[model samples]
Target chain A: DVKVTQSSRYLVKRTGEKVFLECVQDMDHENMFWYRQDPGLGLRLIYFSYDVKMKEKGDIPEGYSVSREKKERFSLILESASTNQTSMYLCASSLRQGNQPQHFGDGTRLSIL
Target chain B: SQQGEEDPQALSIQEGENATMNCSYKTSINNLQWYRQNSGRGLVHLILIRSNEREKHSGRLRVTLDTSKKSSSLLITASRAADTASYFCAPYALYNFNKFYFGSGTKLNVKP
Candidate 1:
């Protein structure tokens, strides 16, 4: 079975503070993604990395960035956390091939006060 | 822009009954996938149906796809308490399979 682990399950930060959410996947998948889920809006993609050091912006990439320094780890960075950024953040990983199902970690619920 | 949209935003059914959810997409797709998310948890991939295929099943879950209408339906037979969760559908575009677009899922509650 594939396992994806997020560093934190619940997080709280003050406004303007920088926040970091870490994710690690044991399966060494080539594709990693970061998304923020809000009520009634479903999951909104923030950023995704197809390979180490390569990142692409998704639909809702503003106010957020990502880092993929290694194949097994992907990081989501909130440059300047605002109240609007408070939401459940999910990390997922999948193989590079098409039609592959993504494995997800138990999301990090972020609270920006 | 969102590609898939699920209808009947919420559903409530008694245990042992069947629950059905529908998803509609805007463009042609290579394949469509379904996922379920328990409260406060990340989504768990349920099933995937390709465009060429009309129907697929896994355990008690049955998924049917209609390419002409760009719609799909998921039927859960003999619903259990554990089956209560928010269900989402992701439609992968024909040319962009890597970029996934998910809609506001259908929330199903099963009464014991």
Candidate 2:
């Protein structure tokens, strides 16, 4: 079975602080994604990496960035955390094949105060 | 607004009954996928139906796709209380890889 591991389950940060969320997949997938889910908004993509050092912005990429320095790890960075950034962050990885299903980590609920 | 929109924002049913949820997308798609998420948990892939495939089944779950109408439906037969979760559909667009648009989801409550 594919396993996607997120570094945290619950996180609390202060305003204007820098925050990092880490994700690692064991299946050697080539695609990784970061999304923030909110009530009534569904899952909006923040950023995605197709390959190492390759990144693409999704619909809501503002106030956030991503890093894919290695194949198994993808990190999401918040330049300056704000209360509006508080949401359940999800990390997912999938094979390079378009037809393959994505494996997701349990998610990290970030709280900004 | 490329996301798939699920109909009937919420649903409630008893155990041993069948539940159906529908999803509609705005544009052409290469495939449509369904996912289930327990409260506070990430989504679990339920089923995937390609544009060319009309129907597919996995265990107690059945999915159908209609390209002409740009819609799809998921049916859970003989649902149990454990089937309670938020069901979402991702309509993977043609030529768009790695980017998935998901709906707000249908909250299913199967009371035992």
Alpha-carbon lDDT of model 1: 0.92
Top candidate on DockQ is: 2
- Candidate 1 wrongly placed segments (more than 4 Å): none
Enumerate clash totals for all models, in the order shown: 0, 0
lDDT string for model 1 (A1-113, tens) is 99999999999999999899999999989999998999988899999899999999999999998999999999999999999999999999999875788899999999999
Docking class of 1: medium
> Which 10-residue window of candidate 1 chain A scores lowest in summed lDDT?
A95-104
Clashing pairs in 1: none
The residue pairs in collision within model 2 are none
Interface RMSD of each: 1.3, 1.0
| B39-75: candidate 2 lDDT, tens digit per residue | 9999999999999999999999999999999999999
Q: What is the Å distance of residue A52 in model 2 from its true position?
A: 0.7
